[model samples]
Target: MNNLLIGYARCSTDKQDLQIQRETLTSLGVAADRIYCDHGLTGTKRDRPGLTQALAAVRGGDTLVVAKLDRLARSVPDARWIAEQLTERGVRLQIGASVYDPTDPMGKMFFNILATFAEFEADLIRLRTREGMKRAKAQGKLRGKQPKLSSMQYKELRRMYDSGDYAISDLAEMFRVSRATIYRSLERTPVSR
Candidate 1:
């Protein structure tokens, strides 16, 4: 049987478009139907349905095509593991227009270099995000999920609870809030307030 060119594409977030990668794969001669994709999945994540399907779809003599090494994997170990699997199965890896020959020392070196950079990029992104969040928190702008009840509403809820006439269920119904919310409010406020 003739070898096939199976393409794999991925986007880390749902907002990120996969059309460009798909077009690139098509331009590289991979059939549209043979292209697989994972949407809203980061390369750091191990469980990717598209990557699994692409790996399983490739047989001996078939080639797996990706737009870039980073698109295939963001970690060195994962990249190496995929390369090894392809090598053992007699499958070729095509990154962009170039076919990676795992047996070649230069190809192996290149793959490793590319994988390291991909991992580095991912690390840098994480660090930057953490720093941004930290700065926002310090500036008092990163207050996590806003309270469901307004401060005035909470005071009123507490007042109703302190009346001794309203049960927790009655207070929740009166406030149009959950019983758990009522319980939490009661826990936070001392009686007679």
Candidate 2:
């Protein structure tokens, strides 16, 4: 049976471009049709549909290709798990231009090290983001989403509603806000019994 190259690529955010990885895989001799991709999916996730398809496409004597180790799996345990599965299925893993030999002791160590680094990098990013948000908040720069209307605006909106001179739709149009916003604003004031 002829061996085939099944390529997989992923990006955690839709904003991230998978074009480079696709180009890299194509350059590595994988046919465009043979490539599967996951957009807005993180490496920390194991249930990626693209990864599943890629793995399923590879049979004995077939190779699974990824642009990088982190693109395949982020955690050490997940990496080892995938490696073991491939080894048992007699499938080879190609990371970029390098073929990872899971049977070799040194190869296993290297793979584990790479996975550890990927996990560490993800953790550091989370830590840095939290720290930055905390600092921003302390400086009063991170007050999330300012209210659409001021307290005075709410009072005026409520007064107009109580006057009964304007319809709800008219009030919304006059205030340049939605009917729901008008309702919410009016609700904020207690009704007089």
| Candidate 1 lDDT, 1-193, residue by residue in tens | 6489999999999999999999999999999999999999999888999999999999888989999888999999998988888878888889999996765778788888988998998899999999999999999999888777887888888888788888998988888889998888878766654
TM-scores for all predictions: 0.72, 0.71
Off by over 4 Å in 1: 145-193
Question: Any runs in candidate 2 off by more than 4 Å, and if so which?
Answer: 144-193
Q: State in Å the error of residue 5, model 2.
A: 1.3
lDDT of each: 0.89, 0.86
Candidate 2 weakest lDDT stretch, 10 residues: 184-193
Model 2: residue 146 alpha-carbon error in angstroms:
8.8
Superposed Cα deviation of residue 167, candidate 2 (Å): 35
Best model number under TM-score: 1
